[model samples]
Target: MGQVSDRRRIVISGCSSGGKSTLLDELTRRGFRTVEEPGRNIVREALATGSDALPWVNPEAFVRKAIEYASESLEAVRELNEPVFFDRSSIDALAHFERLSIRTPSDLKMLGEACLYASPVFFAPPWHALYEQDDERPLPFNEAVREYDWLRLAYPKRGYAIIDLPRVSVAARADFMLRTLGLPLSKAP
Candidate 1:
């Protein structure tokens, strides 16, 4: 296990509509610098460009975008002078594929380990309250549950502590995480 550091990274992940984004927002409010969810940004861009018309046909394209964006996000966050929070990481892409039964790529396997090896990590549990559907969020409840389960399994195997965000409010969750990581809170605004 690694001791906390200014450069340590915390990765938040869960089912499609879970409070991962919510928690990340709170993390920012509390003091941690962060990386936005590349998947979300990619999906938004894809929807704008109609690149998602054939998700089944070119899922790899999405994966590649996630990987590319994750790399950029990590680089940006690494420039911060404090621990960084990620809405999610490239590892989540693996979990996404596992939920859909797609084969995991060898490079992603390496990237997951590399990122995990470089920082302390966090993951959120799926929260149904935050879940709703859109063209970009089409997984069924059962599938989302399976994706959550698979993600829980996948992350720990790579050395992340799945932060149970089931009961805490977004602010409290962020406070608890900073306390848990021993990262000092920023001065009051």
Candidate 2:
């Protein structure tokens, strides 16, 4: 188990375009602190700056940037006392390295373990109906599903419990997450 202070730092991760962002938006709308997905932000920045740190262009560089971004995010929120939901973490970036058959650096593995998140990480399962391709997420549906499969295994291997989010409306999902965390839904504005 992680330090007590870290318990409220929850992580929400899974397949791309699997409603994770929508659920995070709903949580944010309801007044919870939320962290954006590192990968997407990295992609956007890379596209804007013409950096080589893009998943399709240079996966290794992209994952490294993700790891850095996630670490910074964790540090930035360390002082927050309320529940903080993260779209993904360094673990997800490490998992991407594994997916690419790249040798996982010891430092990266240690960083993933060092930056602890609350257990029972909520994973949004692959939702075919909700999945879509956009400028940031260009993976085909099948590839996204494969990524989800990889994530399902990754979280558990890292000693974090996995809870699959139900394929329901974003509001319902937010309620479920709060309920699971033993947080009061009535607190929502």
Reference-based lDDT, each prediction: 0.69, 0.87
TM-score of 2: 0.92
lDDT of 2 by residue, 36-58 (tens): 89898899999999999999889
Identify the candidate with maximal TM-score. 2
Can you list the residue pairs that collide in candidate 2? Answer: none
Model 1: ten consecutive residues of lowest lDDT: 112-121
Runs in model 2 deviating more than 4 A are: 1-7, 186-189
Tally clashes: model 1.
0
User: Which segments of candidate 1 are over 4 A away from where they belong?
Assistant: 1-5, 53-57, 105-113, 117-120, 187-189
